[model samples]
Target: MSNRAAYETVLPYVREWVSYKVWQLRVPGVQVAVGYEGEVLFDEAWGYADVEAGRRLTTTDLFRIASHSKTFTATALLQLAERGALRLDDTVGTYVPALVDGGSPIADATLRELMEMGAGVLRDGHDGDHWSLLRPFPDEQELLALVLDRGQKVPAGSAFNYSNLGYALLGLVIAAVSGKPYNEYVRESITEPLGLRNTGPDWEPARADEFVVGYTGFHAARHRRRIDHVDTRAMAAATGFHGTASDLVRYFSQHVIGQGTLLTDHSKRLAQRKAWSATDDPAGRGYGAGFIVDRIGDREVRGHSGGFPGHITQSVFDPESGLVVSVLTSAASGPASLIATAIVRLLDAAADADAPGTPIPDGVDPATFTGRFANPWGVTDVARIGARLVEVDPSAPDPLDTPTRLEVVDADTLRMTAGNRFGSIDEDVTYDRAADGTVRSIRGGGGMTSEPWSVPEEAPETAAGLR
Candidate 1:
């Protein structure tokens, strides 16, 4: 199916699912935007932006996108590289001499290592109490002193250790090379060029009222206490960014294939290529230049996730499908990442539903099809619903997602019925059987193969009622 058709099928369900999640998680406010092809296909806001004021959240409200600023920083650096101003292999000391002369390991690390989080720089300084809001975020003097005093925690080119300090140093590099303030250069070079009005380096005092009120104490109760927003001065390139979900989706569009106008093909590839694996598994997540790289089924997605004191956000771009989703939440503890991921899964399911294989005759007993299947993505439960068999992701946050009725098409194949409440298109499930006819593996519509889940005799009942 075309992306537009897939988007139309998935959007309604995504909206309902997101609304259900906001209520289920007791999230104070959330904004979501989805981009398909070259334009936004879905934009929505739910819950209260200010719970005490009884103010409703709007999609235009600014959110502290936190570490998402890394992408901007990475983009700027890549632009500078394309101009022959610097090279990714250049050491930090090449731009900032104070760090090198002060015997800091970060100074010796290459810029590429810093962007990919392989520099092994300290995540935060020794006086990292700033994260607890005890003190103001570091200024240039303090930022430099922190790096010089604390130095690096691990050897350069070591294992993947995410370091905000590394990005902050890149911020310094941008200033030194471009002869412009980090934020000013980014605005002129990146945000402004892309026509993003709502995105910026940090909070603006003039726009304070338009910003979503962030909250703390989320873990203790649904109603969290308000948290004060602080200006991340020197760290703006690392953790200080503000924008709406729609703007974020639009910004990320620059990373999509054939949609990018901000960077050249070489630079885009440099930014998106996996530089270091975040997980040990080959198929697990990795860090590209400034983006998190991972796979949902067989498709690859590149983007960044951000977290600040009172806000959390996630953005993902599926280059193959040209689908971008951004989720922003007011509470730091909110399930922004989960909600974003669930949306992507739904989009994938919708696309898969458009093509259902031909059906064969039914011969196998329906009871034999009832079992839990396990895969890298998650668990899929196949259970007998009355006399009908269905498949469902019971762990999904939204309870309204209707199960796909499974019809036996052949001895080992089942065809998913069309027109489900979840809006997922029809697909097929094929089972691998052992010599004695015991199910070995179950392959779902999206090419996800799952092994039969071994269960204990005293385990909970695994039938349709579980949903």
Candidate 2:
């Protein structure tokens, strides 16, 4: 709308921005897509696909979508519901008897409930080592075993804890009800029909050139550990699929324009409804089937966020203005919710032909701000990391900070990366200057902001305290 450049320009910095975010947060890579009215407005690929190889991400980069995969699974289920084959309220036990055997039938779980993440469940195990009986790398049946054996972590219809195992079972229920494998259903119904190329449920390392190689986040795990070696087979419907942002724009476009030929109007609206509400922060909002529905400032957003070992994917399309945005990172960046919040703010202004003003990067001279400023949210240890460049602590031990590279996100505020889901540093490192043009203090990352410390003349110089 009004030359894509007006909107697209803000997105490409993804490479540079994510690079800083990765350095600030110690993440690996990021891929992002921003759009409106079902059309891609902007898309960016930043950081590395394989950091060791020094590979950079492209709009075509691919990474594990993780729980974002729930959107597809829930969509398929809702499609069936729209067809009168299933009901969001139908109990899982009614269809898949084995789901309830001795304990309770995971099948008895309502499709709506599963989509809303209402199923009380425990994590499969955070260590990422336990394999559910549900399925294995090549075999898919182990998924079912996982639900049956593990049962629900909590009573169904309880709190908002997330369960990857829950969506997996929903996939099986789709099979039992539709009589088709989950992959076949997604491809034939979702991908093929949507014409989303370069998108699928797994990876082919040998076919590396076709898609982006996933990046890892374990600082110590590197060299001896592999984070991208995720179990694509067992992670179906939760964190198994991989695709490009360009394709995702097309996919999200369906929800905006009603994909009149594919997804029905009712189904699209159904997908946008709220199901679960996060209680982590008091400001948390509610969840829909697969999407987390909420408001930012005042704008309402419909979408979901995902995080696996090494990838983060966030996608959302506004229902009214047809605005949409999707960011796929190759590292564990921050919560996608924050991004949705950012988009809502930007788009609200964009819809009115306005743009947020750019903030100045830390403008204070290094000398006025160079000191061992102590803070927990972030520590400011100003040290010269390179000639002619004074590196600030936790902000520049980075493999990515450039001289003018700082991101002045707001008029007077500076931010490095986002929170660490995409491996971004979630800090508020803004600066304050004194009337004398000297720096005052710095704030953010959950601590106070300040200028460089001034030593008293009465104090002994150099290691005086130590002596």
Off by over 4 Å in 1: 353-395, 398-402, 406-467
Per-residue CA lDDT of candidate 1, range 1-467, in tens? Answer: 46577567556656756765675456678999999876888999987676666678899998999999999999999999999999999999999998978888788899999999998888987888888899999999889998887658889997889988789999999999999999999999999988899999987999888888887744665446778788999999999999999998888887887787888867888899898888778678999999999876567899999999989999999865578999999886778888888788767655664333222235656656777787888667665433345576645763226567677877788878853634434677898999998999988857678997642222111110011
Regions of candidate 2 where Cα sits further than 4 Å from its true position: 1-27, 105-107, 125-141, 204-206, 218-226, 257-260, 280-283, 333-344, 347-467
Across residues 354-375, which tens digit of lDDT does each residue of candidate 2 receive? 3222222355433443344544
Instruction: List the lowest-lDDT window of 10 residues for candidate 2.
Output: 458-467
lDDT value, candidate 2, whole model: 0.58
lDDT for 49 in candidate 2 is 64
Give the Cα-based TM-score of candidate 2 against the true structure: 0.67
lDDT of 1 at 350: 57
